[model samples]
Target: MTAVGVQPSAVGRGDVVLRADGLSKRFGGLLAVQNVSFSQYDGEILAVIGPNGAGKTTLLNLLSGVYRPSSGRLHLLGRDVTQEPMEARCHAGLGRAFQIVRPFPEMTVHENVTVGALFGTRGTTLGQARERAYDLLERTGLAAHADKEAHELTLLQDKRLEVARALATQPRVLLLDEVMAGLRPGEAQEAVGLVRSVRDSGVSVLFIEHIMPVVRDLADRVVVMDQGQVLAEGTYHEVTANPQVVAAYLGTEEGLHA
Candidate 1:
């Protein structure tokens, strides 16, 4: 399925890695996502932003296969996956990091990441998964805490753990749901760098973020949503300057740039 009014490579970056075509989601009588569509380029960092209740998280859930779209389709790497389950999507190269960190309290940090490496893809033995998990812990700056239980980490460490676990899946595309939500300025900067490293490692990233500065720093392009649908899509500079996008922020663009 082709994205609405999008040429797939319309952003003039790498090849299209993720596409949403006329996507919609309904819970009971309410349409949480309404005919939204966009394309994310390979190796690019695309951000989704909107005001409260604009369906950003709902849209992310759809993309991550948490909620099946009531209508429309989703394609990953040019393959149709609208009917796929979350695990299927993961194998198809889709990974997701949630805003809330939910690590297993009884497992050590290494053990938690090992679970992801073990299950995210097929054919990996326990030994291989453990090795891969250790590599990820080092890559994510958690090597020093590898033996520590998940519940023992600070908020920032837990958040980093979420991203590390997702990366252990070796996904071609990563979906991040406000990974920066609770981070302090310094920690957020570190997370921003980690995300960049992920993109540099050849993963396309699609994220939902509330912090304007982080979006400006990380996103190559942005999709602005309002009232369950896309209001505009373009570069950070372009969307932030859009009059409709400005009005959607309660008639004040200041909040968006702040």
Candidate 2:
């Protein structure tokens, strides 16, 4: 697919899909995210990266309504949704996958995905939802394990299940938090391809990842955060080559910038 053009004003407009401004969150004395601002255009993969405590996950939490920002403005599809609850955010077309897999251990893969279908972007009848869930499983290469208990799947399969479940919600923009964390090299590549396919299907993606290669391969733009604020924002090459990013986060490790 061709790269989309950048429109600064359109980014925060109602049609922009998702926008964050001066977003911050605090827990007691620790400031998780501080005055961070950015926007995700429709049908684009925007990757968020930083060092271990740079607040990447905290930013995702605030955007998805998992944790309300201490002070900030959040807009989804042009509506002021900063104070919306998690469920309301989900209904507003926000889907998320946790860094730690959270599928129901006792439920079948299909069943778990069905919960998303029932409560996701496009609500469907049971039959339609089942068909959609199966299609999503097939797309993610998990069709054979549809009937398997969630706990019985391998780590890679478990991660794919999380993606499928999020897809089942029919979100307009999906927030993936380290879905590629534990995968081997080959597996990570395959997962990256799957994410590209997701974006091609017209859903936007905002991903937080530590694997630099995956970020380079999947993101149309990269946003770097450090010390609770945006440290840099640009294409993969620009962000990686930024001196501040290298010294503070990328370091001299080749793998960190892969």
Candidate 3:
């Protein structure tokens, strides 16, 4: 995997890990995402951002196989996966963490993560899965709370558990949807570090985020969407500076600071 610090083009055209080609999703008459396309390179953190209902989550759903595209194609590590189901996509190295953290309330944190490890890619023995789950708990800072019930955690801890569960799947490209939504600034900063660590481990991350500062800090590239269409794509500074992107977010790029 290439380092995140390098320009994406520097990785060469062949390094594309996840590719979306004219992807769209529709519910009756509503076209949630329309002809959206982008590429996430090896070891890059790419952010998708827009106002509420801009179809960021819908696009993520399309990527993760939560919804098959109404039209167009999706490629994971160069394999066509447009028609695959969620489990198949997971097997193809796609992982997702939803904005709403939904741990099994009755399960211990360790058990919650254990389920992921055991079921993710298939093939691990029970013992190996248990061991991997424990390691992920430690890596995600949930080791101390491993024995605690999932419902006993703070919001931030729950968020970490969400991420840890996803990481247990060992995805090559992890899709995170608003993972930092309800976090305090300090907690968000910590989450930023965690995301960086994930990228450092060679996972290409494509995330949907509403928080601008978090996007600026974590994303090697930004994809801006508005009213179900991609408005712009570039580095944080470049996209935020785009007139169309600024207007879509609300008048000026400074609006992101709000």
Candidate 4:
């Protein structure tokens, strides 16, 4: 299927890189997530879209090991990691970039990324991590800003730094929580290219996005969520055309073109 903004590469989906089966989370009286299930295949770019309080962040937290599901299971690269800690999950090939860009303010951009490369997957030497971090900085177009302190970069540069740091982990699946939330139109377009390049490099991507154009352009498949449950899932065109999805999320069939 053709994506709206950037055409997806001819990468065939292989084995499941990540799987969530019947996952749910409860917060006191609130059931934030309800039995969410989905699989991310190797080399795929998946988008999860929903309105406010739709449990998108909660599901992301579950996937990234920020919160263990109260029920169900999570598998990464064929191994059950439902009970794994955040660091354990990172070492097991899951990486996440949060909605906010929070870098070590005093550290150089390069040093910030180096931390991820060093501890991300384990066994990486300091020298090796530094080299890798430099490479990632180059890839993310932040090499020019490498020596600058994290607090010195602009919002877009900070966002790039966030992605670069996450990529430093060498994860099989990257979970991005609204990486484009604060970007200008041009910046968002640039960020989209970065994501495509990341997928081209063979890491599967799962993102939660509010921007319809971004999702339409980037997602190979869309999983629509509402009221803490999956409302529908399909190609951007297919799901946007779904009446249920239209009613719950898109508002109208014309919303698809929006």
TM-score attained by model 2: 0.92
lDDT for every model? 0.89, 0.87, 0.87, 0.89
Top candidate by TM-score: 1
Backbone clashes (count) for model 2 = 1
Model 2: pairs clashing at backbone N, Cα or C within 3 Å: 14-78
Candidate 4 C-alpha lDDT tens digits along 165-214:
99999998999999999888999999999999999998999999988999
Candidate RMSDs in order: 2.7, 3.5, 3.9, 4.6
Candidate 4 regions off by >4 Å?
1-13
Off by over 4 Å in 1: 1-4, 8-13, 250-253
C-alpha positional error of residue 74 in candidate 2 after TM-score superposition, expressed in Å: 0.6
After aligning candidate 3 to the native by TM-score, how far in Å is the CA of 167 from where it should be?
0.6
Clashes of 3: 0
Candidate 1 per-residue lDDT, tens place, 160-237, comes to 899999998999999999999888999999999999998988888999998999999999988899999998888888
Better of 3 and 4 by lDDT: 4
Error of 1 at 158 (Å): 0.5
Instruction: Name the regions of candidate 2 deviating beyond 4 angstroms.
Output: 1-15, 121-123, 253-258
